[model samples]
Target: MNKVIRIFIKDSTLIPVISIVLGLLIGALIMLLGAYNPIRAYASLIEKAFGDLYSIGETIRQITPLIFTGLSVAFAFRIGLFNIGAEGQFIIGSVTAAFVGIQFDLPWYIHVPFAVVAGGIAGGLWGSLAGLLKVYRGVHEVIATIMLNWIALYLSNYIVKFFLIEPGQQRSRILSDSSWLSSSWLSQLFDGARIHYGILLGLICTFLFYVILWKTRQGYELRAVGYNPDASEYAGIHVKKNIVRSMMVSGVFAGLGGASEVLGVFHYQTIHSVFPGHGFEGIAVALLGGNTAVGTILGAVLFGVLTFGATGMKFGAGVPIEIINIVIALVIFFVAASGLVKAIIDKVKKKIISGGSSLPTSQDWKKGV
Candidate 1:
């Protein structure tokens, strides 16, 4: 089993190609249900997601937040912490970003990072609250984060209504012109859609996450603690401190997720409704992405395509948005039980092993190569 697992990780490319193929194959099976034409529904899905520049822009816009939240959730999972409060963190982050932008008048270069940091700090504090309770009071994070989400939601709504509300409307006041990320420059390729350069920022963050998670000693400790906290303690690691730090880092990612939306996409805080269920969907993105940062990015992009594609599934195939959900559910089912896929791979492995093959050993991973 260890040999097989090592091979799978080492061959990294196999997982992605397999995951996509399986998702589509299952989606095709659903189309055969007769209520909808499989070919047209899927064709419409493709056309809408990438058939035009406008839809591509929309896909990127929608995907931006998922990247941050997905990484946030995936990162926490690495440390054996299930960060269910990314939703709350996202809201809190967005509100703080709004507060900073509205309260200050700094230039773009300074203001943008400042706003993003404010959002991240707000989110980190919330995540820390849950971690603190778990570490000090024996509270389950699942309950604490859920409760915090409500608190954040209500508080954010109140802020939006009273403090951030636009002078004449219920929305937030328009951010300073310096804070706006969109410009006529982006119009060169994305039409009027606001797919700004922030996508690059998201990519940079994801890359950093990948590096930190796989290449750092602290990362190994977190993963070890996640798999078995007692074992990590035996190894002399401060388990509680690591837990708190893990949660804080998780919140930072969630906060970045919120900042990406407010800064990169919307340019203002929105009603909680606009961010409805994003943090939740991010869990699915994390899982489908294999709980790795790079995997999460691909999963998020795949999710974005499905979201943007499903509109055509609604219009051209007369299918409802619910079916898009059904499709996603089916894909998730297959990926979660990767054992089924592994079982199939066993056959190929045996044939190769018979060909005088010796699987890689742990020494390879320990090489720090």
Candidate 2:
């Protein structure tokens, strides 16, 4: 019984599962209130998410950037920084990649990686700018990053208009064929799939982030510094340096995500309507994932599925897809107040373990503080 209790308390994946399940349960309640059949609605939702080739491809496409964004947010959170500028960083990364993607013509093998890596570097620099201001000048990242986002939005628009613009058009010229990631490179098994090799890049990055956070010395120091910076300073960790570096890493992850969207989905420079909600979505994903690499990826996929399925819920049952956002909000609320949920669950689990007996009286509960 103690072992089971400990496993429930310590298993990282269990909490996120509970959060998601609770969110879905609450969503069903909302459906019930709307006079819609909740089970049927959910069934339709699943069908739409995986129904056909095009649906599956689109689902994968939507999930691609999420993996990067989720990891980006998760990485920053581990260092106690709230990186609200992921949207800006993400757009800048894409803009940088687009410029590089079209500026020079090289072999596909060389150009693709070059464009992608350049995007990451550009994003990292952008993120570090905020980090630098935060650490050196005592400016809050939340404020600085948000301001930078507005600057980035306008800058991206101007760049696309003046430099990358196609003569008189809003968009740049089509990227060279060599720079494109052809679906033909995939085997006939996924023959008509629009899912590209960018998915592989995201997955590889996720794994590397996992190793960095869990198996490396730097990871230990990062968590320590985040938890108690004063203590970490006394313990020889450079808290400020770690803060800046972590944010830079966060931006790189976001940048890579932007590249995935541009190279895999857009294929050319675009402006006037750069939708960056995905970067903001990563915040919810990170919260749900509990800031672990594996957990973050799972959270990203779950969100992708939710977003994918919400459209069907909207069209089929006349339900607003915004309800999905409500569900996410509820999950964040509970996770932020985790102590309450944990205490309640502990009471139920203890009761079960004791075969319905009451826990020891208060007078008998002096084992540990």
Candidate 3:
């Protein structure tokens, strides 16, 4: 039992699970204080997310982009890079996809892939700029990415407004049917939900992420650089090139997310005055997932349920949507503070182990039992 307890406490996966439970409990307490029924609210949230086919489909739709963005962040972390500019990369990809989908007329087999690839290439190039700055000019990735996010926002808007805008609309023109990733059968199965092939693509990317990181020579080099750049350089690895390559690959994941949203869900790109928030949310997903490929998918699912269920909580249980936001924020906080949680778990485990084999007490010594 003591051994089992120690193993459980030492498992890194326990942290996020505990964090999620704590967040939910705190949220329930908050709801009680606000004179709302937490159980009912949660029930409604679940029902809204998975009660029926339509809800399940939409929930999956919500999860798809997060999977890609989470993979993007997780992939970068494996190479010791902070890809804060996933938002910018995603935007570039979306606009580039929209442009390709609109400009070209081709068969469905060719057109869909062409547009997706265009988006990925655009995002990769955009992300590589930060890598270039870091390698050549000695700028920090965080700073470069932060600046690039704003540039991407404005640049994407310009491309939409000037090149692809629908007349009298604030969004780009719709892609041709050939470029649409939607399957009529799938849509009908989900009762007309906007779910598409994006989720499948995200799963494929997750597999690739795992394969490229753990099973390939390039992945070994990237991990080596991440573990110790000086040693890797001493061992004849091209540290600078790896940095650029890491960023490019990370950007491809985010870019694919953007392209998927345009090609599969919305079928058009909107010129936003602000970010769509997927990139930022992805940071949380990556953190909660411990930057692992499978963990990322799980994290995305948790977030997807919480996000899509917020509406149900509001309409079904009369809970304010702000409460859900607070709950999510608390989850992020707990995840960020996982070191403290681990320490607490460690202390408990130590107590349990020590108690099982503790020295005799003074009374026991005197009695000589």
Candidate 4:
């Protein structure tokens, strides 16, 4: 029994599970301080997120982009790069898809794929810029990605406003039916929800990430280069090439995420003053999932639930939506600080088993003299 318990504690999954619980507990404390009932708020959240078919579809719709962006971050992390520019890549992909979606009118099958591929390519090129800067100019990836994010944002705004704008509207022209990924059958099945085929595409991408990384020679080389560029170079691997490739792939995923938004959900592009923030959220998902393919998928689902339910929480339970953010922040905090939390837990367990009377003050102080 003790051995089993020890193994459970040592398991990789245990840390994330504990962190999630701890975050919820802390969030509950915050809710209490705010004079809100945490139990009622959480129950309402669950009800609105999964109670009905429509809600479930909304949850999956929310999960789709998260899966792509999470995989984008996780994929880059595997290759020793910090892709802070998934937002930029995402924006670029969205606009490129929007451009293709509006400019050409092809068959449904061809048009949909053409727009999606355009988004992926645009994102890949955008992501590769950071990689090029890192490998050639010796610029740090973090700094390059951060700058690229802003550049992508402004570039996207310009493309939409100056080039892609409709004659009389503020947003880009609505995509024709052929360009949409929406499934009539699926929407009917879910009682008129906006869930589309993009979720399936996202899942396919996740599977590809797993297979390419763990089963292919290219993936092996990429991982090798990531582990140690000097050693990989000695082993006849082109480290620079792999670095560029990884970033492009990362951007591809993020770009697809953006394309999913346009083709699957919004169906049009709007001018934006700020980044959509999906890239940064991807960082949180990657960290929570320990940067694994399956873990990232599950993490995205968890975040999706919280995000889709936030509205219900605000309206139904009168709880602030910021509570969800607080919980997410705490979960990341506890994951990052797992060792400290574990040490504290171990000390408490030891004290319980040993029946130790250890105290910071003296024995006399405890004796109530």
Candidate 5:
């Protein structure tokens, strides 16, 4: 039993799972304090998220963009950078995709790919601006990214207003059908749940993220730079270039997410006074996922379920949806404080080992047979 406990404690994957469990338990406690039945609330959440085909399809849709943004943040973290500007990149990508989708007249094969790629490129460029600022002007990426996020937001709204707006609407013109990523068959199957091909793209990107980070020479250099920049520089790696490239790549993931939202779900872009929050949520996903491709997907699924099911708690159990937000915040807090949890576990392990292996005292020796 001691050996089993030690082994379980050593497994890093268990940390996130434990954090989630702790968060849920604390949330339940809070609910009880508020005179709410957490069990029924959670049951309603699950039922709303997965009860029928339509619910499942919508949940998957929610998961799809999260997968992209999670990958974006995770990829940046692997390179020792914080990409706080994914919101900006996403906006740029969406606007770029909208432009292409509205302006281009081509077959579905060409239009779809073109519009998506355009969005990615635009986002990549937008993200690289921060990298460039960091490398050349000595600006920290966090500050640069935060500033860039506002710029991207305002710029996107301007573009919508001047070039793409549909007459009196605050949204851009609808994309041409050729550029749409929606699947008629899938929609029908899900009973008009608005499912699309973007989820498939998200899965493909996850696989690519794994391959690029684990199986490529460039990945090695990026990881090396992240581990020790001076050592990487001494080893002939161009750290500056890699930094810029990493940010660009990170932006591409976010941009693709934005494009997916436009082309697959909404088919139009809205002028927003504030961020859509996907990028910020992505940070949470990345942390929960431990910055791995598969982990990000799982984290995205968890977040999707929680977010989509918040409505169920509201309507079925008469619990305030704000409680779910509190639960999510608690989850993040637990994840962030995982080092303390590890310390506690280590203390227990030491006590167990010490108790099991204490030297026999003089009294014990005299009493021995």
Candidate 6:
């Protein structure tokens, strides 16, 4: 019992969990302040997220892209690089996938994978541009990536307008059935829900990320460089190459996210005046997940549930949907403050220990304190 308590106190995962719980408590308080019943609001949110087959499918649909973008940000973060242009990569990937989906006529097996590959390649190249700029020009990645996002946005918009746009429409041509990832059998199973195979693909990628990062020599090199580039360089590791590789891989995930959105849900690309917020939301997911594969998956799911259920809260309890956004923002804030929270927790634990507490005398707990 003591050992478990000590582990729980020191475990990194506990911070995020406690942060989420606190976020929910604050959300409930907000509901009360707004003269709304918190219980009904929460119940409604729960119902809409998991109450029925259709709701479950919608939650998964929302989770699909989140999983991809979350992984993209998390992968870059693991390399000690901040990738703020996942939105751009995602946009380019979607356009590329839509281009392939509409321009080609092939069998389903070939067409689907072909579009996916095109999206991934497009995103990878876009991400690599930032890396190249950082490596050769001494430009900061944050500035380079931010600029590239606009470039990609305008470039993709031009491509759509001049080349791929339908003659009578602003958006690209609708994708062919063969290029879609949605499954008829699965739709039927979910009572005509929009869930697709993309969720499974996201799960596969999550596992693959864990395997590649933990089991591959290249991954070790990337992590080592990220941990300390100067040290790695002195140790004869190709730090520059790893930086480029990490950015490319990060873009691949973002691009796949955009492709999944097009192939599984939207089935076409539309003109965008602004970056879709998915990329930015990914930063929150990566941070909350501590940049771990399993943690990212769980974080994405939590966001998915909140997103899918927010409308239900509005309708069922007369609570504003924006309150859910507030809740999410608070959760992110708390996650960002985990170090401070842990310190306070440790201080409180020490106070209890000095006051004749039943705490263990283990080195782990002491170090945590």
Candidate 3 matches the true fold with a TM-score of: 0.92
Query: Could you tell me how far off, in angstroms, the CA of residue 13 lies in candidate 4 after the best superposition?
Result: 1.4
Task: Judging by TM-score, tell me the better candidate of 3 and 5.
Answer: 3
The C-alpha stretches of model 5 lying farther than 4 A from their native spots are 1-8, 344-354, 357-369
Over the stretch 1-369, how does candidate 1's per-residue lDDT look in tens digits?
Answer: 586766555634454456556777767676667567777888898888887777788788778878888888898888888888999998888888888878789989998889888888988888888889899998888898889889988889888888888766657887775765555566458766667665766788798788878899888888889989999999999899888888888888888777667776777676665446678878878887768887889889988888778898888787776667777776666666555655555666676677545664334323632
Tens digits of per-residue lDDT for model 4, 1-369: 476775455435767888888889999999999999899888888998998999999899988899999999988998889898888899999989998998899998899999999999999999999999999999999999999999888888888888778888778988887999888889988988899999999999999999989999999998888788899999999999999999999999999999988998989998887777788889878888878899999999999998888778887779989899999889988888877666655666576666554332222322532
lDDT of 4 at 255: 96
Query: What's the residue-level lDDT of 191 in candidate 5?
Result: 86
For model 1, the superposed segments whose C-alpha errors exceed 4 Å read 1-34, 167-170, 273-275, 338-369
Q: Per-residue CA lDDT of candidate 2, range 1-369, in tens? A: 487765554525445667677888998899889888778777777887888776787677678888988888899999889988888888888888888888889988999889899999989999999899999999999999889888877888888887788887778777776766546554233436567777888899899898887789888888888788899999999988998999999999998888777877778867757566878888888888888887788788888888888898877787788878888787777676665555555666676776654444222322321
The lDDT, on a scale of 0 to 1, for candidate 3 is 0.88
Q: Per-residue lDDT of 26-105 in model 6, one digit per residue for the tens?
A: 99998999899999999999999999998898888988888888999999888889999898899999999999998999
TM-score per prediction, in order, is: 0.84, 0.87, 0.92, 0.91, 0.91, 0.92
Clashing pairs in 1: none
lDDT of 6: 0.87
Off by over 4 Å in 3: 1-8, 346-354, 357-369
Window of ten residues with lowest summed lDDT in model 2: 360-369
Each model's lDDT: 0.78, 0.81, 0.88, 0.87, 0.88, 0.87
Q: Output the worst ten-in-a-row residue range by lDDT, candidate 5.
A: 360-369
**Residue 355 in candidate 2, Cα distance off native in Å:** 7.1
Clashing pairs in 6: none
Query: Which of the predicted structures, 1 or 5, would earn the higher TM-score when compared with the native?
Result: 5
Clashing pairs in 2: none
